[model samples]
Target: MSPRKSVAEALSTRAAILERSVAIASAEGLEGLTIGRLAGELGMSKSGVLGHFGSKETLQLAVLDRAGEIFRAEVWEPARPAAPGLARLRVLCEAWISYLERGVFPGGCFFVAAAHEFDGRPGPVRDAVEARFDAWRGRLRKEAGRAVDAGELPGGTDPDQVAFELLGAVMALNHALQLHHDPRAPELARRTVQARLGRPAAVTGQVHRDPPEPTTAPER
Candidate 1:
């Protein structure tokens, strides 16, 4: 094959590996990933699979990165167009719940699984997992702070506290889903978040209402 074609094929193969790796890691922890299994599943030789990522740790890290991309696409991107503050935050919460309900990761939330798997292990893998969660919570806190500044939330409201509550609800959702296989878990999570956030700020141009007639019917 020409050099360009070879490079294209290599990229394609790498993409395939990451795709499979994310799904496997989601359901079975990152440790479950192995060259032999991936090669057998993808019909590639062990060397070919290993060639894409030189080491198991490297492959695990790559899987975390790929899973983060998928998370952004499925959850974050959908909420991007909403007006910031409570409106955007509400959209984000909804999208996040839907992402889990839709099984984007096959094992529920990839980061959640990763966090549980690596929360204690002290290593690069654990650091990567922690970083992902930190970014998510940071975004939540930023939006909550925006809501406060915009007067959508009470002035005394703590953005980090809000982030913690929201994260707790979704974390419970993942637990219910993976443990009890509860069908109502998503609905419960949505309600919990909505109650905590209260009413979302109405988006301008989202609805139209006719002008109200005068109480005294004007001069008629």
Candidate 2:
């Protein structure tokens, strides 16, 4: 077999640069993230950082994609195992708020921060960030529909509206927790989502658990 790829392999190189971009963008907004700044912070040569991304816009898009991947892993995946209905809805909301509360980045949510930065700026970066934002909105609608299908939520619920509200709630708490670094705002957001979905206020996080086995520990 061929030798293993180097640590600076193409994919690894891109990932490393994207991670650095995310950190810079999160702290100082996208404007503050430049090829030079990233290279300087990462202690890599300017040409080294440029070699991976090729251009500033490409780097921004890469950072946005990487941030979305991070969000899905930390927030979406954990909440996915929850029963696809009210239970799942609560889990998803709590997962979102808790992620922001934990301060995954110094600046708050990567998506939320990026939205404001790129929102009116015309370019690939704006398109990419907006697309990522809308993707979460769509995911929310799908989950909300599951709730209606199971009769866990009131019938005739508007998936679009519910999706919008959940997004708003997450953003509201994201703003507060990041600006003030207060625990209460995040807690309030989490509880509000639970209450809206008729879930208990325990915030157990048990909803994200694996499905139960058919039998308790196979008989010997």
lDDT score at residue 115, model 2, on the 0-100 scale: 77
CA lDDT, every model vs. true structure: 0.83, 0.74
**Highest lDDT against the true fold, candidate:** 1
TM-score of 1: 0.91
**TM-score of each model, paired residue for residue:** 0.91, 0.85
lDDT of residue 79 for candidate 2: 69
Q: Compose the digit string of candidate 1's lDDT tens values, residues 128-218.
A: 8887777788888888999999988999999999999999999899889988999999999999998988966455755323233211000
Model 1 accuracy (lDDT, Cα): 0.83
- Candidate 1: stretches off by over 4 Å: 201-203, 206-220
Clashing pairs in 2: none
Query: Clashing residue pairs, candidate 1?
Result: none
